[model samples]
Target chain A: MQLTGGQMVCESLIREGVEVIFGIPGGAILPLYQTLPEYPKLRHILTRHEQGASHAADGYARATGRPGVAFATSGPGATNLVTGITTAFMDSVPMVIVTGQVGRSAIGSDAFQETDITGITLPITKHNYLVMTAEEIPAVINEAFHIASTGRPGPVLVDIPKDVFEEMGEFEYPEKMDLPGYKPTVHGHPNQIRKAAKLIEESERPVILAGHGVIISKAYDELMELAEKAQIPVVTTFLGIGSFPDDHFLSVGMPGMHGAAYASLAIDQADLLIALGMRFDDRITGDTSKFAVNSKKIHIDIDPSEIGKNIPVDVPIVGDLKLVLKVLNERVKPTTRVDWVQHVEDLKRDHPLMHERDTDELLPQHIIQQLSELTDGRAIIVTGVGQHQMWAAQHYTFKEQCSLISSGGAGTMGFEVPAAMGAQVGRPDKVVWSIAGDGGFQMTMSELATLAENKIPVKFAIMNNGFLGMVRQWQQIFYEKSYVATGYSRNPDFVKLADAFGIYGARVTEKSQVKSAILKAMEHDGPALIDFVVEQEENVYPMIPSATSVASMIEEPKPEEIRQ
Target chain B: MTTTESPKHTITALVEDKPGVLNRVSSMFRRRGYNIASLAVGHSEIANLSRMTFVVEGDESTVEQVTKNLHKLVDVIKVSDVSIQNCVSRELALVRVRANVQTRSEIMQIVDIFRANIVDVAPDSLMIEVTGDEDKVDSLQNLLRSFGVLEVMRTGTIAMDRGLGDEQTDKDNSSSTHRMESGL
Candidate 1:
């Protein structure tokens, strides 16, 4: 039963019920790979790049609600995971990153391939540890899992020295972690809860600003009940896309700098603001002093420090959103504020979320809508950040939180396809869609091989605008429409590219053929890419530019008043 | 005035041995818009295992809920209202006071009055070490400060039951008994 540290790590991972580990090998982690083959149940996925592996792990974490494990060796291998780790950290995704450290004696001396990964990742991870012995490896892994998945869940790292993995020790996993100084309080003061409930009951124009915490805490049903009881309008953060169904009467879409005008206006006029599972990031709350000035705010989040960090909270509730929302729903009286609801509806009708409709051309919004309708809100929709992603957010009516996953924090361009493949593996029964622009798709197009190899049948809808659409839009607005390096001349034929991977592919240039093309892609059963040649000059409008007050967004330009 | 009784209260805490646990604990109450008149924590029967004692100055119902929530954390092992239980509390402080020729004899007399020990004697300073409850430490520190106290270091207050029974002892004895019975 005695095993080396390398063997012990694989054994511990096996014990944790980890079926697959995504990693890239190098000199520092040779010992780990040497022992990995012995564990038949644990599969090791050899990623082409450490970034892909980290993102794949992140995808798995987002899909499964469990910490996805990824490993890499020191130096370049570890550095490659930095962008992915930061992506996971910024979005509060739970992950366990095990990096192969240089030998203990060589550390700090800057020996070959040695890097201070723990020091480098200090600010990004929830907590990290350097294992000195094989015996400590199991405990550190256990602690990493505990910290990564617990309150305000975030990524944790364990840097394992090469020598420690080669050493021998008793391999016993600790049942409980003894982190004395790291207790997080997860319940609200009853008096404060009561006070918050009373304020909700009293306010006429109340709104619920739901964020990613709602999804993380699985509080959608409770949030719905609270909204119904208070009859308050609900707007969401980009990450909280599907928290409340877009079809719901009270569901105004996301409210922020790039959010729907009606949602932003509602937030601007609210008398009582109940912010749940939201950090009130700068994107959401512009000029914090001016945001929600007329409202008495009740801020509820899992982390205590975030309660008043950005905006002051009249009543701060610290606990899991599900529990807090359930309790709040129970205490709050059922009352309908019809007048306030109608006022929001008025805004919605006055300046609707508009997309330029081109009858003969395949548009991004049209493609996204057909995709949403085809999936019937059951698919996992991931997006590469750009006009395509925003179009999906604006048009697709997602039914649940986490249903629409994207890199909201880092907004990494190449994350959609591989992340979608990772998500599909987690949700095998459901369809997974990766909606990326022509510019974003090319960033991680190599992941097409991953899909083909793994037999993960993801639907990739590439809005082929033949340019970096968002950047192009900015250039059009800010700079004279000179079109610098934004446009692409000889774009690769996406159908031929998908065919190169030995999968189904199609190109839809006409609007009439868009639905049939998507349906055909969905029917293929293997990985399929539908490159819809959308209008190159199309821009995502109703966009409240950064730092611009949400109240005064330039709604769609009049039909004839268009400058072009 | 509403003729209703308020809830009970208990101060439950988990503390580290870093500097200023007392000031941090007490000041937390002040900062969070609460008031704490009494507080305590010290090394348990187990080394580096510290026990905290603090009274929750609040309504009874609110105090009960707070204690329950606090005990839910892994760091917080036990929660008991020392106010209800007969307990002993103690604090240790080292006071370094100026000991010039004129003040040395007077300071020595004052130290003796408080049953303090001169742990260190520099050319012009005597370090007087004292241990007791909060009031005793405060009174002693006041007396020494008048003698031109140079510096002060106090171990935060720690408390335990006056009787033989304690959480640390109970767990230790149970484990030992189990080991003997199992013969492992």
Candidate 2:
């Protein structure tokens, strides 16, 4: 049957089981928008900006483990998706970005709204394509989804020329992809698995350093079983927060820069480090030479390149983490490291994560703790990057898998709101919260309209500190407190801004108002915003100075020295 | 493993003949802070597959990392470090140099010493084509420079292992199984 390129895109998405998409309409993408009414089953949520659409799709992907779909127009519309696309790319979130381009003839002629999106997004995407004909739409869409969701999932872009969207052609979606060079290894080598098991059995102080791969691979049960069977303590990376139950006896907590001091000390002291599905990012490994200096590392990652790219591994197993853990769980013998567990407990007690509450002013840490307590550590907490992000990671205890969704690799500011909306849309049953600092919230607060329009009940907690808190902290600690562009002299009344968007809003200035305001926001049927005016100059502690070894951590100052 | 000096490495990769594969490969090198000395790419024996050869200047670990990272790309089929292999390598260079009435004969004598061909000749300049190992091409380019070489374009090294008879053995050795077996 003959179909237009726009129809082919819709049909292919339907065939791929995509039920929802986030996009904004514009001149170049008018054809797709015109055909949208024909397919009522595929729901399109209109976002105020392309960046919001892209981030919402990313949040949806992270929540559902499916490739989220997003659409944008040519040139500026497509360029706006760059930040979101890079965020998804850095975090390995599966996303398919469909962008409209100028007509085939006008591509490089600099026609109206014409941009080389494929060229610009080349490095940021797992793969991308430029379609010149309508007949190629189905195949391109199929390939785009497949490539985006396959091994080491990431964002893929498919740019279609406007003429192709209007052209008529035969449409057929291939049942099987003919990508011979794109095979991903899913099974670990038996020898490597056996060697890793041997290492697990022999080691006395073994620690499982879990990363985003654990959640992506859905290896939570296997990870838990391995930890239980080997009696090994688990320390999660920033992105790996919810992979292991935080309340579990074997779970130590997050480890890295701004990680729990005890967790960092445990990683430093471990004799054997079993790294699962996580790249040793620089933030996690302060100084590569001194990171886990005493440990014999066993790295298991689906991407073979990540195994030893950062840190040399003693036993490198290249395959899917879930499959490898399943096999290793069966072969590995049950053992106990009583002394190691006790040592971790002792360290945790000595260097606990706590802030002084001697002042009457509201503290961000206390508010986050209240939220965690109110939600029983079960809500899907999405946070933008900054001081509040680190505070949330430190205070909000995540007990469920895939619960904490944040921009870990990219550390993108303004990610929380749209991402929280996507998460709420993806998982309507769960409680979703977007925690943001003052600076990051202002970056993409325009998405508050998208939430109100869609009636997506994503509660937002703005830790308003009146400064770019994280950078301010760095300047205060590293530099001579030259506050440059960090401070915002005049800030908008957040409550009034939220009310302007037709959503419930409240401002909590005193500590007494924090709990009631959060409760009120949680009870609201639709989107709500709570502005918690937190202490302005707070810093994340246990920071390993840049280019320094993890062993040399800057501990929190004496409580008497802290200014209220 | 403890080498202090950076060494030149010859890397060969098999990739799908798809759009942006070149950009993907080159951008990775640039983004990862690796230097590409020279690069050559052409269609391979197989259908829809292209072969890419590039020379990189890095230590042993960096070269190892480069090969592993190239393999991570979905478009890349296989990656091999041919620097340590018993292989026959060749590069093609086209050098355009000044060939005035006085220097024409002298240039011809030097070209003859290197067994190169004069592909194009103008009144003032001659373009010579030469194919050999990197050293041979480098020496020829150096000698041509004395004659005021106008421009030089060299195809980076394309290498293949010495006859393993089946020839496919090299491909098999470059497979993931071989990589796993070799503990790389």
Candidate 3:
């Protein structure tokens, strides 16, 4: 059937299983907007800002593992999507961004509302396509989803020229994509797999380093089996929380700049390291030369380029995490090395990971633990970066991989709320908790409309510390507490902000009310935010200060010493 | 095996074949880090697929990596560990030599011994095409140095097994079987 380019977009999206689109209408995208009402199943969210729309789409994708779709007009509309797109790219989330453009003729002429959206987003997106005709729109959208969700799994953009949307053409979507040059490696090389197994068998102490790739590839079961079979302890990177159950005997929890000291110590002591689906980012491997010095590393990842790019590997297996782990699990023997396991247990005991709040005020860590208890591991908790993010990372014990999908590498501030939106899209049946600090929540507060429009019941736990908590903590530790722009005066009542968007909200000032507020928000049928007026000065502790000398660590001084 | 010093090197292979063959052949190379030193593919014996010769460099470990990976690509019909296997590895180079009366005779005499053909003869320039192993190519170019060679276009090393006939089929080398046999 022949349809206008704009109508083709809405129809193609429906075909791709896209039910909700978060965007703001503009002149360039008026053609697409005209056909939205016709598709009753397609829900279009009118966001306060184009940035908010893009983030909502990002949140949706992150939550569900389905490609999230966002719409925007040309020029400024496209520009606003850049931050959210970059965030998605950094975190490796799949998204199909549809943006309206000026006609092909006015592209280089610098016409009004005409911006080079493709060129501007070239570095961030995995791949982008410009649809010159209506016939290409369906195929392009199909290809975009396939590319975005498969292989390395990153964001893909599709820019439609305004004139193309106005023209009529036959609609057809392909069942499969055929790109000759774009073949992703799926199976591991047999030799590399063998080498990894042999190394694990020979070593006295073997450790499994889990990362987000396990979640992305859905290899949690494989990861658990490998760890149990090899009789090795498992440690996760910051973004790798919930990759293995925290309650598992072998699971050592998160390890990195903010990781438990014992986890870092365990990494330092291992003889053979089996790194699964995790990139050894600089933050995770603080000093590369000193990281796992006694260990011969076996790095398994789907992206071939990432294998030897960071730390050199003795055995490198390039393939899907699930496939690779399955093979490794089959080859690995179920041998019990009681000594090595006991050693890790000893370290865990000596350097126990704990949180202590020596104050009468309600601490942020207390609130996070309370949420964890209240939800009973059934909720998906997302967090923005800063002291609060680290505090949650330290305190809230996650139960599954992808349950906590916060921005770890990019440390993007406004990640939690939007990512919560994405997580909710993925898991509509469960309670989605977006845990943010006062500073991070406000960064993308405009996304409240996205939740209101979709009626996605994501409860917001905003730890209102009245400052950029991480930066403020650094100031307190390094610069004698001479706070800068981190401090802000009394801000807008978040409850009112939520109310304005036609969503439920509450504010809690005292320690007694925090749990009740969270319970109330969780009970509400729709999207809600709870503004917890948390104590501002509490610091995320046991932090391994970014040291100049590897041997020394400047631990946080006692609160009494800081007063002097 | 008892040698205190044995420097390991790599062999370059040029093959005529189809697509999906790379995954099959590279799967033969046991190590994943077996770097493809330089693989230049172009038109060769067949028109549909083309020929590719990859130069891989490494120690003994790298050789294992190369052989194991080569067998992984579906389209690769065969892989030769030519570095150790007896094979005549050769390359072709076309040189545009500056031909003057003074040194032309000497250049021609040297070319005759190298078995080089003078494809083009101009009043002041002579274009010669030479094909040989690494040593022969190097010697011929060295002998042509006195004649003032102006330009040279050399195709990257393309190779085949030393003695070749329809002896081995692509199916004979099952990647899975070969990998299991190698105990990878």
Candidate 4:
């Protein structure tokens, strides 16, 4: 059937089973917006900003196992999506970005709203296309969706010229793609699996270091089985928080900077580190030379390049995590390391994650604990990067796969609000919470209006420390406490800001009010914000300083010593 | 850990002949912090595909990582570290030298010794074309430098596996031919 390029886009999206897209309509994309009404089943969310649209799409993609779609016009509209695109790329989220460019004749003339989005996004995207003609719309759309959703998924952009969107063409969606150069290996080689199994069987101190790959590959069950059958401890990376049941006996919580001290100690003492679906990023591996120095490593991932990209591995298996774990689970035998388990328990007992309860000031950790308790540890917790992010990662007990969605690799601030909106929209049945530090919250607090506009009942918790808490912590520890620009002399009244957005708001200055504020936000039935005024100088403990090994973690000072 | 001297490596890739494929491949190298000494891209044997050859200076681990990263790109069909393989390599350089009537014969003699051709001639300059490995081209350029070489343009390094049967041809027949026939 013959259809205009804009119509072809809608048709192809329907074919790809995309039910909703987040974007704003502008001059170049007016044709698409005009055609959008024809397809009543496809929902178009009008975000206040292009960045919010991109991040909402990303959140939707992460919450659900489907590729999220975002749309924008050219130039500034396209550039605004760069941070979200890089975030999806860094975390390997499946997303398709559509941008409308200037007319073909005026593309190189630097016409209004004309940007080389394809060129700008080249390095970050898995693949991108610039459509010059309407005839190529259907095929390009099909390819964009295919590339974005398959083989270690990431973002893909399709920039359509405005003229082409108005032109007519024969619309034909191919049933299957014939991408010869883009095949991903989905099964592990038997020989390599066996070698990894042998390493698992022979080692007495085996530890399974899981990462976001575990959630991406949907191998949570397999991961649990492998950890259980081998009787090995499991420690999750920051993004891998929900991959394993936190309350399980084998679970050792998170490990790295701001990770549990026991988890870091366990990794340091392990003889075999079976890294699954996670890169040994610098945050997880404090000092590369000293990171699991004695452990023989087994790294498995879908992307072959990630196998040896960081620390050297003795057995490298390149394939899907679920498939590799299934094979390894069958080959490996049930074993127990009673002494190793004892040592881990002792470490946890000696170094418990705690704050000074005697202090009258409201604590961030206390607020998180109350929020987690109020939500029954089941809310989808999303966070902006900083001290609050680390506090949430340490405090929240995530038991659901993909329940905690934070910007890991990019460490993007202001990611919490819109991402929570996306997550709430994707999973309406579940409660979604956006936790941000004072510094990070102000970055995108405008999204509170987005929440009220969309009526997305995502709860918000802003840790009001009155300073850039993480940077201040670093300055205090690394420098001579030169406060510099870390401290904010004044800040906006968050409750008033929320109230101005027509959302329920409250402020909690005392620890006694933390629980009630969280419960009130949860019961609001609409978006609500709770500003918890936390201690300003408080720091995240068990920090492995830069260039130092995990063994050199700095813990909280003793109460008696602090008094002196 | 054992350390080795970083050396120049000739790498070749077969990629789908599509818009922005070159940009995608080049950007991958740049993003990964790999220094590309030279790069050349052109049509290959099959339609809708192009062959890219580039020289990179790196150690064994860096080269391994470069190849692995190149393979990860969706447009790249095949990546080969031709430097390590038993292969035939060549680079073409067009050199313009300051040669007058007096030094013209001397420059020609030196070019002839390297089996090069003087493609263009003028009153004050001569354009010489030399095709060989990097070292061979380097030697001729060195001898011509005494005559004051004005300009040099090199088509990096292009290579093919050396054997009775071409590995790329065999691999392409099994995997890439069907896609080309499908016209995707």
Candidate 5:
């Protein structure tokens, strides 16, 4: 049973059901890479950068609901994964990160390629370890995977020195993780569940604020049943985009800063709020003083810490959403609310979220809307942060649970390219598209080379605006239109960039060419990109000004009509 | 969510006796912007487990968040906010004071009244060791300050519940026995 630390890693990961590892090999990690060829079952996708590797792992985890794995060398390579690691931490994505360090004797000696990755990722990861000896490798790796994939899942890092990887170890995998401090509560208290059920049955106007926890717990069916049984409208948070079907009858759409007007309005008027697996982020409840003013909240989450962290709750049930909802569904009375539904409908009709359709210039919303329909509203849509992210969330109708994989908590600018590639790799059966803004596209367009090399078939839809559209809109609204460094007027040709990667590329500057270009990219096979030249100054509507009440959401701009 | 500040609360935790457990606990306090009034860490009653006591200053919600976040760490075994419980807390301080011939008797009188022991004696200085609550230590330091207190070393407060609750908790919660059975 003697094995090298590198073999123990491979064997442990195999036992954990890891089929692929997204990573890059370097000086410190060479020992592990040398052993990688011996194990062909672990498909290693070589990314251009460690950042891309970590983000791809995040995307894979989000797409599959399994812990995604990433590997990197120490020093700069490990530091580069910081943003991606923080992104997963913020969004609660399950990821296991393995980093190679310098030889044990050379550690902390300013040795080449030696960095304290476990220390650097301490605040972000659920748990992390620095394997001191070859013997601890198997157990540490097992614990890393277990911690990453359990409870309120987040990334976990395990740092291994080069000497340890080369040293021999007894490699029996630990079947169970025995960390006393790591137990997660899964079942709800009966009293709390009963209180929630009573609240649900009594309230005339109820809105279910479904957050990312629902998706992580895969409580889609239970959520639907609860909403149906109680006839409550469901409003998803940005990260909770596809937790419930976008086209479901009870779906009122997303609610937040740039969320749907009707969705926010519904929350403003609701008598009771059932917040499931979603934290009351500031973005969701802008100006917490006035948010859901009259609603009594029932917060259910596996993490006890998240309840009352932001928004105060009336009935807080600490447990897994699926189990809590199962009991809650059993206790609640089934009834329909006609007046509440009609009121929400009226709000939806009064404050519809729409983009300018009469314009001849290619609108990003139009392109996303068209793409959503063309792909049958089933493609896994990933987006970079900015105007394009909001546009995609608003325009595209997500029909499947966890179908939209985008940076929510971290809001990383260059998330689209690599995350889409990872999603496509994880779910080969589903079509994956990267809808990125022009400014964010250039930040990580190098990932396109990884896409082409791996033949990852992720379609790219770059919303080619001349500026960082979101920032530009903010400046226009708040800073007297001084664009500053927000303009990327001399951006590179995205089609040409895609072509350089040996991927099919197309350009669409008019509305007429949009559908055809998307179709052409879809037909090209391996990987494809389409550059849609969108309006330069388009704004995401129904935006509640930063930290303000949803009551201050700007439906349409008025000249000198600024509120006090 | 409450930004209002309040008096300090004594929080205690039983954590794994790992090399970086203290760093993990302290780092989270700094990251979450929770101010630490004082901290004490030592070997606990159980083998391979360390108990940490932190006096943190924040409002109800913020302190609740601090405890919750601390519990989130995989190395932390159990946490208790002893401020809300019937707990006995103590701090140990060794105060070195300028004890000249004229002030020596006066300093001895003060130390005797405070029930403190003069652990070390020098020609012009006396080191008094006092073990009590923080307030008692603070009072002793104040009395010795006029004698030109040369230096002082203080161990931050440690606390324990004054009942059977803690003993029962330790019996039920100690996972020190739950070790990873490494065949190596």
Candidate 6:
């Protein structure tokens, strides 16, 4: 069919099953916006900034397990997507980012609003393309989606010039992609699975370390079967919070810096470590040399590079976790780990994760737990990076798959607001809570207007501590109480700001008002914000200092001894 | 396996002949902190495929990482580690050395002994071309150093395994010939 490049792009997106896109219009990409009216199936959310657009797309992908689509103009618009692209890259989210370039004639000429975005994003994207002709639009878009969504998914950029978007072309979408170098391992070697089964049956103490791959592969059932059959406890990584049920009998919880102490202790004591789809990131493994010292690890993952990248393993099986576990569950025999489970349960009982607030002051943990409790631990929670994020991870109980979404590897500060909008848009039937500290919430608070315009039903809760809480905690511990520039003495009234943006708003200062405020926000038909005035100096405890061993974890002080 | 001795590896890769693939290759190497001793690229027998040969210094795991990382690039089709394998390889060097009045005859005689050819001759210098493995080229350069070598250019190592109907082979003799030639 004869079509313009813009029509081809819109057609290709629909062909790829993309129903929504989050981005802003710019001069270079006007052709796409002009063509948008003809295709009513494609819903475009006009984000305030390009960064928010990319992150919202990221949140959409995380929630739905489908590749998210985003659009932007050239130059600054393209550059703004860098942080979001890197965030997706670090977390391995699948997204296809389309950026408009200056006319082909002015590509290297440094024309107005021109940027070599593909060159800038070389190392960050899984693959990128600079389309010169309109004839290749359908094929390029098809290839971009295929590459972005398959085999350890990541963002792929397709930079189209304004001329290409306006040029005439014959659209033909390819049904299959032929990429020899991109073939990923999908199934494990049977011999290796047998070996893993042997180890599982022989080991007295076994611990399962689950990561985001389990969630991405949707292997929760297979994982539960294997863990239950072998009687091994599961410890999830930071981003792997919702991959396993937090309330399960064998779940030991998250381990590492700011993670539960018993989980880290369990890792240190295990004789066999069955690692699934996690890279053993530095934050998770405090000191690589001493991490799980007594455990002989068997690492199973789809990405072969991740197997031995950080920590060496005894059995490295490269395959999809769900398929690998399905085969593994057949050969594995049921075992009884009565004493080891009891010992770990005792450790969990001794070092139970809880909130400590001496006075009647409102704590962020109290708010997070309330949100979790009120929703029956089923609401999808999105968070930005900071003390509030850690509180959400430690305090909230995740019972459903993909229940917690946060900027984990990147630790991006301004992620909550737009990401929550994306998550809500992706799964409109489910309830989503946007939780952020005052420091992080202000970074992209402009997206509140986007939320109001779209009527995206996300309940936003601002943990107003009046400080960059995480940085302040570090300063208090290592900098001898020198606060430096971390403290914010004055702030805007968030409730009033939410009201200005045409959303329901409330403020909570007393402890008694916390539950009611959350309930009110949940009961609101549309987007709502609750400004929570929390203790300013509370630190996330059970901390493992950077590069320190699990033995050196600093426990939290007693509630009365901390502060009034 | 000695701690003091650094290990070196030879890798050859097949990549699509397109723009920026080389940059992607080098960028990955640079970002990963892999040290390259020599690299050479040219069109292969295939129509649109280019072959690249790189000689790099790394340990056992580092070499494994280099091969695996190169494979991750979408443009790269095939990669082989021929560092210690039974492969026939060659290096070419053109040395421009001081050769005035009487020393020119001695230089020509030494070149004859090494079977090297004089590619060019200026009034004050002789440009001698030598082709062999890395050790052979280094030996000729060392012999000419006493005559005050003016300049030299060496095409890094390019290799092919013996008895090659296939581009890759699974045979191994486990010889340590690389240890003898992989030195600086």
Best by DockQ: 5
- Writing each residue's lDDT as its tens digit, candidate 1 over A308-406 gives 766888998988888877777889999989899999999888877774543565678878888888888768898988888888888888986679888
**For model 5 chain A, the run of ten residues with the poorest summed lDDT:** A555-564
Flag the better candidate by TM-score, 1 or 2. 2
**Docking quality band of candidate 2, CAPRI definitions:** medium
By lDDT, the better pick of 1 and 3 is 1
- lDDT tens digits by residue: candidate 4, A1-564: 999999999999999999989998888988988999899989887787888888889999999979999999999999999999999999999999999999888988989888889899988888888898898888888988888887788999999988889999998888777788888998999999999999988999999999999998999999989988888999999989999978788889999988999999899999999999899999988778888987999999988888788789899999999988998999999988899888888988888987455777677887888788888888899999999999999998787788998999998887887788888889999999999888888877777787898799998899989998999999988997888898889899988999899999999998888887788888898999998888888888879997688768998777554323
Model 3 C-alpha lDDT per residue in residues A463-559, reported as the tens digit of each score: 8989988899889878989998888798888888999999998988888887788888888999999988888887775666663212444343565
Off by over 4 Å in 1: A355-358, A482-484, A560-563, B1-184
True contacts kept of each: 0.11, 0.61, 0.00, 0.82, 0.96, 0.64
**Which digits, one per residue and each the tens of the lDDT, describe model 6 over residues A1-564?**
999999999999999999999998898999988999999999999999999999999999999999988899999999999999999988989999999999999989989999999999998999999999999999889988988888888999999999999999888888877676678788999999999999998899999999999998899999999888889999999899999999999999999999999999999999999999889998889889989999999999988888788898899999989999999999999988999999999999899776445568788888888888999999999999988999888989999998999999999999999889999999999999999889889999999999999999899999999999999999999998899999888899998999999999999999999988899899999999999999889889789999988989988877766763
Give the backbone clash total of model 6. Answer: 0
Compute the interface RMSD for candidate 4. Answer: 0.9
Q: For residue A51, what is the lDDT in candidate 3?
A: 75
Q: For candidate 5, lDDT tens digit of each residue in B1-184?
A: 1111337888999999988999999999999899998999999999999999998987888889999999999999999987665466788999999998999999999999888999999999999999877778998999989989999999999988656464445433222212101100
- Chain B TM, per prediction: 0.62, 0.83, 0.63, 0.85, 0.85, 0.86
TM-score per candidate, in order?
A: 0.77, 0.94, 0.77, 0.95, 0.95, 0.96
Tens-place lDDT digits, model 5, residues A307-365? 99889999999998999999999999989898998888898888778834455767788
Q: What is the DockQ of candidate 3?
A: 0.05
The candidate with the higher DockQ, 1 or 6, is 6
Residue A189 lDDT in model 6? 94
DockQ, computed on Cα atoms, for candidate 6: 0.70
Candidate 4, superposed: residue stretches over 4 Å from native: A560-564, B1-6, B100-102, B164-184
Clashing pairs for model 1 are B7-B59, B7-B60, B7-B61, B8-B59, B8-B60, B8-B61, B40-B53, B41-B157
* lDDT (10s digit) by residue, model 4, range B84-159: 5545667899999999889999999998988899999999999999988777899899999999999999998887
